[model samples]
Target chain A: MTRRRFCATLALCGLAPGAIATALASEGHELRLGLTPVFLDDQSIFLEAWRTYLTARLQRPVVFVQRGSYREIVDLLNQGQLDAAWLCGFPFVRHERRLRLLAVPLFQGRPLYRSYLIVPAGDTHTKSLLDLRGKVFAYSDPDSNSGFLYTQFALAKIRERSEVFFARTFYTWSHRKVVEAVAVELAQGGAVDGYVWETLQRSHPQLAARTRVVEQSPEFGFPPFVARSTLPAGDFKALQDVLVAMRNDREGKKLLGQLNLDGFTPGERKLYDGIASMAEKVANRP
Target chain B: MKHFMRDLSLRYKIPLRVLVLASITAILVTASILFRVYDETRNDLLRHAESMGRLLANTLVGPITHDDVWRAYEIINSPFQGGSLDQTQIAETILLLDTRGQVFVSTQPTQYPMLSEPGRLDPEYAAIVDLATDRNDVKPSVVDPSDSSRLFVTIPVISEGARLGTLVMSYPKSLFMPRFVDIAQRAALMTLLALAVLLPIAWYWGHRMAKPLVRLAGCMDQIGPSVPENLHCDLSESHDEIGRAGTAFKRMLKELKEKEQLEQEIMASERLAAVGRLSAGIAHEINNPLGGMLNAINTFKRHGPDDPRTLKTLALLERGLTQIKDTVAALLVETKVEIHPLSRRDIEDTRTLVTAEAAEKRLELIWENDITEDLPLPSTLVRQILLNLLLNAIRAADKRVECQVYRDSRSFTLVVKNDGTHIEDEDMAYLFEPFSRLSRNGHGLGLWVTYQMARQLNGGIVVESEPGETRFSVALPLQEEA
Candidate 1:
């Protein structure tokens, strides 16, 4: 089987890398990770490498529950239906009382990414989010930090409700979908994840060809892997150690390279205070 | 109404038709626009309500999944507090129904949160909950049956492939009705504006269009049976339909004038033909008699002259010859009309010639002359008129014919009266008409020639007749040298 296909199947079957033989012999615990489709994008090669390396380090079966919506994945994570999830800082802060940060993926050796507001390439009217008032808009997800929450925070800064500012809006449930929707003019503007948009621009230029970035939000903490607050102490520590030390292991390094990510880091809670403050400003907006 | 419309004048009819057509078109267009506006407003309102309902359902999904009823209630009540959630005033009430159709959370807390099961709640809600539970994949939509203006949209909250509950949102059509009304008002105003602009133009156009036709009609009316030969209308240069009609009318008038002239010429020709026919017979009889008289005169002149008795006889013969020559000279037809003054002697000579015919017919001829001075007129024309009247009177009178001639400051009148059968009323109207044949004695060119000659002299003739007395009067205006 192709490495990606094998790894995806193994992930679906909850088979860890070194524990594959043991997984076949005994009933292995299923480690469910709530994932948004934006980070997946059918990149089975990278997806398999990441899952295989993580599973090998954890020495347990790892399974992924793929839902297009961030809100759904966040809710699943909050409900403890998923063992852990890689969640945006906005949703992470939203469910902070019930969720705890495990680790944050570092890109360019830093745990930070910005929010991008984009429009069709030929559009010259919208130079920023404020110019998109009363226009049709697409948001990746209601819970997405860079895609939805940052836009809300920006509008909240001007004392405007995003729902009222836009003529009409709907969620595409994924950052790549926001780009595609904007490219096709299905939406006049979009709020999307900067990391996902840039990655697609480099890897799939054709899909990003017709979209132009109108504005970017201040850099915030990159999305971090999170688990329920009530997760067992030993299990949480094991997942955290595996993610932070991934750059040292040969297979983990290879997987990290394929994912265009540096090793994971123990993200400080204060690093996410910016997203939390924005989220609080939006939630408390009158 | 139909008869009234039919009887309306073209001037009124044209404008009325334009008004009716324009009004009907305006009404139809306005109605179409209003209907479309109402339809679109209704759809937009429904869509907006549905979208709000979906948003509320998504927001409540988290709290409901966590079984946090208080948070659900708080979220449901947010719209009523003039918050951003219901700033459009689309939702009137919102209720979160558990999977069993029990109202777990509601904005209208006192009235709702009904403890009833799925089957016993509002039928539409129950139906929606049933449908959502049966098919979690399908979105449930409902509108209140009792009031169509109120929309009820139900959204199923599915968490982890399990039906958590149904979110029922109540939104009335009142939210967008004002906007619809404003649109309708605008449409009506526009239609009225169009009508206001168009109607006057239509009226003016109709008036301009009808004017030519009205003028043409007036021209037609003026063309009566006795229309003057010089009648004309001025609409020949126009290019519209009415103009075309005017042109056709003018052409017909021209033809009619030509026909009238031809008829008058024919009447004059017929009179001349009658005169020619009588002249032939009169020449033949007069010539024979004149030859005998001339021989008698010549023999009398050659045989004897010195005796007083012979002298008297020769004078008598000379007088007879002179009278005949005068009568012949007076009867000759003259083409060119010339006026002359007449003295008492001319009347005496005319009476002397007609006295024989009157005596032969056994009629008493009474002649009166009130004119003392010489009368200046077309002598030949007056003589012809006098002779024709005298003849006709003599023929009609039982035993007496009266003739009187008078002169006034302005005119000269000749009155001829006869005690004979009166002329019939029907015949009197056309009595002066050419070739008018009433009876044997009247059916000739004698009277027709008299009528024509009088008109040529700028005079008029009238015949007034009753049972026993019929009078013919001829009057001519006296024109000075000019």
Candidate 2:
């Protein structure tokens, strides 16, 4: 694949609906990963701390790559080269064969984050998925639970129009990006994780001022870092054990502190299966 | 290439048209037939392969496994492998697949170079992966990406109520493609050969038709201004429409030539008659110059130009020049030309001139007018006829001149008479004859020219001149053809 397409594929790995760990548990060794876009020490400081910690503990170098589109990421994952990824819910439902999750992120003592459907501050749209019709809506990524899966479930409850109702729809690949899409009017409204919104309110009040919450959905599991099926069985076991025990250890807590998490939890594989089902229900939205 | 284009451009246009039309029609017909044949043949081949594939896959129904699919593929491809069958004969293919969605074998293995790799993935494997993983509802289906010109068939290998996987079959479709290329090349070569054969026949037909027309045009151009005309191309020599037309044309040309020769004779006689009348008028004027010059030269023998003789000689030279000028004026008047921008006043002017001339001749003229307001005759001819008659009457009149101009819808008449003369019936018949003078110091051509001028305008004149009264009248018919 071309370098540009490789980058796009790497980016799409996050948009795919799955935690990389579940896929990695069944995969062979090496744990090659297609990560989301890079960190700028802003909304992603926690990701860096976790990666640094995970690599140190696992005693293997962690590789990060950027991809352009969610479909390309899933393509790489299906190729068996991409052992793990942190993806949004779309690819998980789209390519469940190559992907699954491990542990989801937590902040302020909660294992979940509410998805905020935000629009411009003076916008007339009210609470409901149907109200956003003929308006541009954004998703942070196809894989993020709050960004896509839970919002997709909300849409299923109200109206399933992921394909058509909106005048336009897009992926911004991060909760902060989804909020920016709505704030800057690139999209009329978007689904963002509540945690990212709160942080933006604290750090960039101008961005927070640009948008207002039009609707809120029930909480969904936070973004998860997964391993691939290609990873050795022993390595997959080791990685999951370490992630579950991070809150109990002093160094892990300190590392977790940098990412603003209360603790990590032992996630069940079946916990995100409902996300896939939610996608199916919403796929035929009229 | 430049010369080719120039030669094409220089092609004789009439025949070029015929050749182009014929070649284009032939080529379009041939090409259309060839394309139709190619499409039908290719479709037939593909259809056969598809049915064969279905039958082969049916053979695998009890055994839709990897090994069975490979066996099926091998069995199907085996027929075309040896020299017994021509690969170039519209190559086409069919495929059989096992349940795992793998193309276990192909009819032509070398066609898909990538498939040679062991454990290699399908180029569209991503799409297959998505189809297999994402939707539980969409069953085994067939997709034809005709843009890529490949046909893919995915069959479900369902046995004993369990989904074993997908049986994927891909047809490399380029088999029929190369056949079309060969057919097109062969078709083009044949079309070229046909056009080459047909062009000369078109030219031959075109030249045969146009040859007579070209010859006629050449003959017309070569028959210059003064040639005698006749139907020279013999009608009796050939039995054809052209021969009849040539006979008719020659007769028409002969008639026209006679009319033209008659007109010329009249013009020459009129010129001679004018010369005679003009010579008399000139002599009187020239006599005055001679008389003055003789008197001046006698004076010059006694004195010089600085003396009394000089003024007299100058006066005589001026008189001679004036006589020459008067003769020139009359000559200009005689050669009748159409007065274009013809107007009502010009005819009136001629009528008035006749009356005035008769009055000057000291004849008690009796004049009458019965002419239309707008006479449909050129004023130059009108004036000439009136002047010629007046002049003749002045010469013949012993005491009186009688003049008449009258017209009805279809004719015009001019008559002049002198009561000083009368003639016998025999003499009256030749009264308008050239040089037949009846009186002393008289030019007889006046009546003759008047007679000829009338005829030129498709009319004639009669006269009665005798001792007591000589009458000359000219009648002109107004024909619509004029």
Error of 2 at B440 (Å): 19
What is the alpha-carbon lDDT for the whole of candidate 1?
A: 0.74
User: Top lDDT: which candidate number?
Assistant: 1
Q: Write the per-residue lDDT of candidate 1 for residues A1-286, one digit (tens) a residue.
A: 1233345655655543445656645874657777665464456556656766666778776676666567778778778889888888888887889999999989878999899999988787777888988877878777888888889989988999987998767666678778876775657789888888888887789888789998988999998889989888998999899989988988888877766688799888988999988888888999
Q: Which numbered prediction scores highest in TM-score against the true structure? A: 1
Could you estimate the TM-score for every candidate?
A: 0.37, 0.32
Error of 1 at A57 (Å): 46
Interface RMSD score of candidate 2: 21.8
DockQ computed for model 2 against the true two-chain complex using alpha carbons? 0.01
Q: Considering every candidate listed, which one attains the maximal DockQ?
A: 1
Which regions of candidate 2 fall more than 4 Å away from where they truly are?
Answer: A1-286, B1-22, B65-174, B177-200, B223-482
lDDT of model 1 at residue A254? 82
For candidate 2, the TM-score is: 0.32
Q: Candidate 2's error at A174, in angstroms?
A: 57
